[model samples]
Target: MSRTAIVAGQGALPGLVAEALDAPLVYALDGFAPAIPAQTFRLERLVPLLDAMADSDVSRVVFAGAVRRPRLEPEMFDPRTATLVPRFLGAMQSGDDGALRELISIFEEWGFEVAGVDAIRPDLVPGPGVLTGEPSAADRADAARAAEILAVTGPLDIGQGCVVAQGLCLALETLPGTEAMLDFAALHQGLRPDARGAKGVLYKAPKPAQDRRIDLPAIGPDTVAQAARAELAGIAWAAGGVLLLDRKATLAAAEDAGLFLWALE
Candidate 1:
């Protein structure tokens, strides 16, 4: 019987996926410890890890949470991984989406189907509509600007999120991730060049060209709380392109903090 392997990363996502699976094989990276007990492995030992998985009858794989790029040491590479050095280097030059796609191809070549967390729990991906509060006209316009910013920047492999307030672009998610971006927005809420007093909207979506099968955008209760602290009116995300972890608590948090969570149509 083939078993599913959950390649765990850093965050609450892996645990959520595992809870819904039937006897899942959890392989977590060395540095990024998942909240669940998992078999630890390093990317440097890719071949050996695959061999172990094959021996364990693992046929399906799903990746969850954030993974830091490992430092590839040529001396640590096995004979097989050594041959792929050129491709790895090439992936590095092409940006995150390209690199992830290349990695997905590698998993496919090993005869394992790489799926997103949605495979285990589709409910986490909500349909279009607002989960709380109501957005005003200005909020909608800000959201449109944020959407345009993502559309323009997605091809550049910049980020999946941006903040726009009163027709002003406040922040764009960078290497630091969404939370950091929100913190940045919060810090400059009233100090930025513009003196507008209107609240903003935080918009998130998968990179237009990104392969959603691997890394999809995710938000939990913490995200809603952060957005509220940022003094934003609400958050808007692409429907079916983002994951809402712990849906119940997240929605409640949004309600408690008086922030809207809209899944754009």
Candidate 2:
């Protein structure tokens, strides 16, 4: 039997990937909120998990969902993990992307192929074009501005997504993630007369250097509702670089809310 291991994290994405990939080995990261239950382990148990995977004949690993970096204690490290402390610490200091890359490298070194979730579910990544409703010229312009902003910040390891209204960037997503940024945008809406018409966009794209396999930007039906509540005109996301969840429902919600959903190339 071919076996794949999902180092699951928070959100529904992990469970979705597991379902699409068939019932493979499911190991949830302990303390990480996952959509489904699975055998759990903390970050400090890396070596033991690797051993279990090897014993199970697992040949591939795909990481899914979001997780905050855990602070590992030296006492929790096994002999094998102890040897890796220096490298792990260095990666942590570098940034999230660097740390993920290091983790992927470690998984590879342990003889498992690292896979992208898109491999299991390709339809989730949509192509470039208008997905729902119609975007006004102003909304499109704001989308362009968002893309420009992402270009400058992507390499800096900042968060994805931004809110732009009336050609002015109202909020940039940070550690709090997209929803918080949307809330921030909604709170500050209509500061200018031109912005009072709910003419803005929630634009999202993967950082240029981001590893698509591990951390693709994603939006779902809830996002549409959030954007609607924010009184925004629409949402624009980089085509083939972001994940769309609850596809049919998300589109339907956007249509009902009179919100445009564009997949920007």
Candidate 3:
């Protein structure tokens, strides 16, 4: 009777993974999860959770959903967390890819095989195709331009998403995230509601040196809604490199909103 542990975070992805694996869900107390039986731990109280896993049949660990870095207080550090402070601080200072890899290393050091969410749901990675709406020639060019911008920004660990319109770079996502970038794009000079044709395209891809095991770019129903609200031509992402969460619902949203969802090569 093998058991797997899900380090849950925010959004529907964690719930999806839990359902897919029938795994024990664990999460930091600061985040949200479904109203189900799940073990909750504070950011610094990881040892107890690890010990509990060791005592159980759990052999693998998978992380799902998004987690913002928590601020740590020196007074709150337990003995185990105190010892891990250096590594934790290092990961915090590094790029997201490096941080996730460090986390994977930490879990592996505790004798559990770390699994990527893709292991449980391969179909989340859609192949190259236009999933909804129609992209005009200008839209296609914007997608290409956004991709080119991301190619240069990725290696710097800046961000995964960019928006382009009429051959102009509308916005680049930063620490504020993709949705905020879209909001900015929505109000940018080039994206007036009365503008002819489509406004722009949102292009997202993984960082050039990102570890495929975690922190892959993801788009869900909210993404489609935001793209639609941004009055964009479409949302474009690297096929097999982005997680299309709730594929049915996402496509439905895109179709209803008249927003194209393109899985680019």
The whole-model lDDT of each prediction reads 0.88, 0.86, 0.82
- Give the range where candidate 2 is weakest over 10 consecutive residues by summed lDDT: 190-199
Indicate the TM-score of model 1.
Answer: 0.95
Over all chains combined, what TM-score does candidate 3 have?
Answer: 0.93
Kindly report which residue pairs in candidate 2 clash with one another: none
Q: On residues 31-117, what C-alpha lDDT tens digit does candidate 2 reach at each position?
A: 886888778987787888898999998999998887888878789888887888888999998767788889998999999999988
lDDT of 1 at 68: 66
The Cα error of candidate 2 at residue 54, in Å, is: 1.1
Q: What is the lDDT of residue 252 in candidate 1?
A: 91
> lDDT score, residue 103, model 3?
83
lDDT of 1 by residue, 115-147 (tens): 888878898999999888898888888898899
Ranking by TM-score: 1, 2, 3
| Best model per lDDT | 1
lDDT of 2: 0.86
The candidate 1 region of ten consecutive residues with least summed lDDT is 189-198
